[model samples]
Target: MSFSTNQARIRCTQLAPRIGDGPGNLAQIETELASAASDGIDLLVLPELATSGYSLTPSEARDAALPADSPVFARWQAILGEHTSAVIGFCEHGGEDPSGVLIYNSAVILTPGSAPTIYRKLHLWDTEKSIFTPGSDVPPVVDTPFGKLGTVICYDLEFPEMPRSLALRGADVIAVPTNWPYISRPENEHAPEVVHAMAAARASGVAIACCDRSGEERGTVWTEGTTVVGTDGWVTGEMAASGRYDAAVELAGDRRRISPRNDVFGDRRPEFYEL
Candidate 1:
């Protein structure tokens, strides 16, 4: 497929959200949004549950949950520049009744002067099942001035089909809001989750920005693996001393073409393989 060549400055801000501290977390996010706007970032990605933090109990999750129409989103929108957009994860109050309240691990894409486009996390991690309801809808690909941005949560990236599906749907960049738990790995090796992200980017010929969280929560340490992978499947950005990963990547153009005669998507033989 052909695409117009466009450049975008992307930043992944790794934050340390305090568990259950909604006010404080919002303040931190607001500050970052202002800074991103000032820095001329076209796409800013934030860690999952950035507003409520990870490691929350059921009641804590509910307490931190915000409706999709929360005024805080508008506040965030006001802070963003005309060319800057952000994707942030938060606990969502899906619904409530006499039986119980539904909560979701959700991410919202905020564009200046536009309604927020929210995506609930379809795949929950190990303990997340106990607190959040898995999303039932497919991820959304939103059109922006920079490019078509696709949204996915942390664990959702583990499913190779997720990024592939987004690419098939014409996504230019995939913004992943993740909170990766620290896992042991061989020295000098990328974290397993980052490896999965890299492979996904290469296989789909799409750029991917994964924003991982920092700091420990409830005795669990974070990998702090915030990274950006280019269309060619190479690590283009890593966390800097400021705890942010920044990169200027191609948001447009025919990245699927690998060789003069070979195109990554064009060479697929789906008819013979059963997924």
Candidate 2:
């Protein structure tokens, strides 16, 4: 399943995932997955918490979350019977761990005819902090036929280290499944998340597929950020203001060199910088 090299087809989707509507949400995701495959998309990235929805209290989140080995894996396996890959987000029933926190917002990475690899969110957003635990493990860099893929949940992208670490681990693309909220920025501009994404992409020199869910949830409006940044650290697709679907992206090269003398990753002087 090697990538197409100069051209890789990918998509980001945004949806209004209803709280407690697992069946309905799963159905909607299936429809989108089918459509993306039909539209020649090689990889489809879905929004974070796509299964159980966000904005849950601790008890509610626990009730809604599916265990890591839930039947949803079987459904996705059936979905990917032959071709295509997808990154689906969900609330995970992390169970009890005396040493640390349980209950995580997770991203399930699925390839054709294989078990899914789960990546929990490392940075828990506002209300999320109360309900979910931060992921302790580093996100896996999955080696597919197409590319080296990695996944991160919503707020993880805000940390520059997250994507940079993935890139350093040989990930060609980082899929971000996010549920962003509107914020008061310098000029009430478009999503500042986009700006951060651009910086992350450039700094890490990896393409990014950001899937942000939309529609107001409990009076909180989603920032509608469905985007794909190219390897050159530039926004390639439209970040729809009203939640639109489908963005085709081409991922090329493992390196980002500004010129013959300066390479983005090669020029890094991490040794001198004190963290």
Candidate 3:
């Protein structure tokens, strides 16, 4: 289907990233970039730490971390098409900070004719605390020709405050690069990670796109949970474990009211309750 200028064509990739294999991982990212252009995708979101892989040892994380101006980023910038924007995950070096880990698990947003934007993971998972530092900055709601774009990493979406604030700040679409792993669940149900994403999308009246990886890293298996949720809380498109999934999402900033009398934001009673 053809997308109008107001509609955003988004794609997510589910692929296994080899741990500490920078060159191999970069090659995979290059292929995906070409694929995104071929698919005519407007926004492409890749899995968390996709360029460096997850489940790395502390030393491995340090070895994989790269400066913000690394040649790999320059390469990605060079290959991106005019209208396409991409979000990819990597380990970032924290130049002279004395507190916290010297590395951060971060995502870089690549826009056609602009400098890249960086977002560090605020909510650290399992062994990640030992390997990277937590971010303290508020994730930005970027303004682009395509839409009001926001982004958060895997665990960050679990907190309603994250998406709610982004939506309140005029973000109509949020991109998530996750590393969801297998956990105990019912025989035929979706992963909890996806459930959280859907709920966030519907509650905030925003489009949410996620990219999750496949295959095991350091004996830890991933859920391969790739999905896109519309503002209505229902999923648009997703592939099983490998491949690209596309969705034409409508991010209407003016459609927040449930009815003529009830506004999604106007009904808020934040003064009565406190965080």
Top-scoring candidate (TM-score): 1
Clashes per candidate (backbone, < 3 Å): 0, 4, 0
Per-residue lDDT tens digits of candidate 2, residues 131-179? 8888889888887657889888877888888889899888888999998
Off by over 4 Å in 3: 99-101, 240-242
Model 2 shows how many backbone clashes?
4
Q: Flag clash pairs in model 1.
A: none
- Clash-forming residue pairs, model 3: none
How does each model score on lDDT?
0.90, 0.80, 0.84
Show model 2 residue runs off by greater than 4 Å. Answer: 1-4, 98-101, 186-188, 239-244
Lowest-sum lDDT 10-residue window in model 1: 1-10
| Local error of candidate 2 at residue 153 (angstroms) | 1.2
Q: Write model 3 residue lDDT over 44-127, tens digit each, in one string.
A: 899999988998888888888888888778788777777778889888987756564479989998878778888998999988
lDDT of 3 at 121: 89
Clash count (model 3, backbone only): 0
Of 1 and 2, which scores higher on TM-score? 1
Better of 2 and 3 by lDDT: 3
From the highest lDDT down, the ranking of the candidates is: 1, 3, 2
Worst 10 residues of 3 by lDDT: 237-246
